[model samples]
Target: MNKVKLLNISIDNISQAEFFEKCKSGVVFTPNVDHLMKLQSDPEFVNTYKDATYKLCDSKILFFISRFLGTPIKEKISGSDLFPAFYQYHKDNEDIKIFLLGARVGVALKAQEKINAQVGRTMIVGAHSPSFGFEKNEEECAKIIELINQSGATVLAVGVGAPKQENFISKYKDQFTNIKIFLAIGATIDFEAGNIKRAPKWISEIGMEWLYRLLAEPKRLWKRYLVHGPSFFWLILKQKLNFYVDPFNSDYSEPYKGVTREEMG
Candidate 1:
């Protein structure tokens, strides 16, 4: 498999169609600019990423950067796009039962309803909007795990945002005996639930989705886009100049080195 290395992380170089064919079961984490920045400082987030079955490219900015690095990614497979495609691809498969975990109180339920309606069947078998800071509470996490197991879901898609969602999956993925596929999809649940509007296709295609989102929720997303996002380019430059360093490992200097789950262990 081909990989596009940006700075400290490597993104899988795969198209949406290829992803659908290859990824039958396993944890999928889509890495964007925000995720990349988070990985720079957060050892926990980096560890969580190391456990991911698929580290997919979720940002057009990252895609463009890969080109600048001379290893162009095949496609950008953002979580918001991947979720709809995933259900649509498995629409006829009765075995693809999905349980959504994220968003506000009624948001996951709304997303479940909308998705099932579009798929013409109950593709989403269960949905839960976990309380804020639910990841910190052991009892709450265990209860949620039991709930998902009881729902008979084969796929679990969590859209709680960033390292939180990724860390949750990394810590408790094995506890889900019935779940075959796990997706760390940030904000997709809210988009599906109609609680938030996604950027238009044209804006997304033009690689201005971040700008659109920043404008949409200025107060909430300003730091992610304005503050942390620009550092991605500087990191990319470091990689290009062969001066990039992994924060966790001082001796390592490779830019395009990909780390699999086994490699991490």
Candidate 2:
């Protein structure tokens, strides 16, 4: 897979189809500004991304910034977008069982119900909404891990929010003998369940989805959008101007450096 480094993180430069083709089993992290910013302080989060099967671009602002920095990412492959596509791809793939982990109480169940109703099949084998800080309790974590393992799910969609989802998987992934795919999809469970409405298509196309999200939950998202968001643009400027130490430096190795699916085919 071809990749480019943005903020010292390896971001896959692949089309949506290529993304689906390549994703098999392993952690997937979609790095937005918030995630990238947090990476500066979170070593575990950084390692999680480093070990991910797919480190996709999650934010349009980050995509624009990548272009402005002259190391363009090919596309955005957000978990919210991919979750629906997962169902679409696996609609007839009964063998590819899925599990939903980490939503508010009943959210994943509702999402599963909606998927079953609309898709006309039963793909989700299990859904769990762990209590807050359940990870802190060894007994609870063990029980949940065992439940997931027993579900025999091939894909696990985790929505407990960033580092938590990633950490949860990291801590117990080995126990998941049947699971192959895992997505650390923050709040996508809410979106999938219709608990939170998505923005209009036009808004998303114009890269104003962030604005819509900000307007949707200003109380919870203001600091992320209004405060930390500006710093991203500044970081871009710094990268563009070569104004900082090791400005825009990327040491990422793309093993499939010049390869593509079409060419391989």
Candidate 3:
């Protein structure tokens, strides 16, 4: 597996077709500007990323950044796109049962219903909508884990935002003895349930999805896009110039650790 380095993280330089063919079992995390920005300051999130089996480029902006860095990523595999494709690809595979966790109180169930209808089968076997700050409650997490295990789901797709989703998966992944694939997919459940509409394909292709999302939920996403997002460009520039330093460790400045050839299998 070839990976491209960005700041302190490595993104798999794989296309969607390649991802489908090779992704048998592992944790999948889609990294975007917001995620990268958070990674700079969030040590736990950075550590959690080390546990990721597939650090996929989830933003067109990242694609452009990779190109600018002279190590272009093969594709931008957003969780929103990947989740649907994954279910469709495995629609006929009886053993590929998926459990969707996240979204609002009823949204995961709606996504489950819609996805099953689209696939013409119940590929999403279980759906859970955890309460606000549910990850903090050990009892709730235990119950959720138990529910997923009882559902016989082989895959777990968690759509809670950012570090919480990743952190939850990292902490409790070992508990789910039956789960093979873990996807930390943010807002995908909302898209599937039609609770939120994605940006137009052209907008996404042209790298304006951030603007589209900012416009859609300005109050919620303004800080992510308008405030924290600009820092990512600056950081990318620093990385390009070999001047970027990991905030967690002032001595670490080696951002050009490119093409990590790992035995993912």
- Looking at candidate 1, the ten consecutive residues that score lowest on lDDT are 253-262
Root-mean-square deviation of candidate 2: 5.4
Candidate 1 residue lDDT tens string, 86-147: 99999999999999999999999999999999999999999998889999999999999999
Candidate 1: which pairs clash?
Answer: none
Q: What is the lDDT of residue 152 in candidate 1?
A: 96
Candidate 2 lDDT by residue in tens digits, 147-247: 98898888888998878888888777887888888888899889988999998877776789989999889999899888877876776576566542222
Task: List, residue by residue over 1-265, the lDDT tens digit for candidate 3.
Answer: 8888888788999999999999999999999999999998898998899899999999999999999999999999999999999999999999899999999999999999999999998889999999999999999999999999999999999999999999999999999979999999999999999999999999999999999999999999999998987888898888888777767655444554342324211
Q: What is the TM-score of each candidate against the true structure?
A: 0.95, 0.89, 0.95
Candidate 2: segments with Cα more than 4 A from true spot: 243-265
lDDT of 2: 0.78
Question: How far off is model 3, as Cα RMSD?
Answer: 2.8
Q: Which stretch of 10 consecutive residues in model 3 shows the poorest summed lDDT?
A: 256-265
- Identify the runs in model 1 with alpha carbons over 4 angstroms from their true place: 253-265
When 1 and 3 are scored with lDDT, the better candidate is: 3
Whole-model lDDT values for every prediction = 0.89, 0.78, 0.91
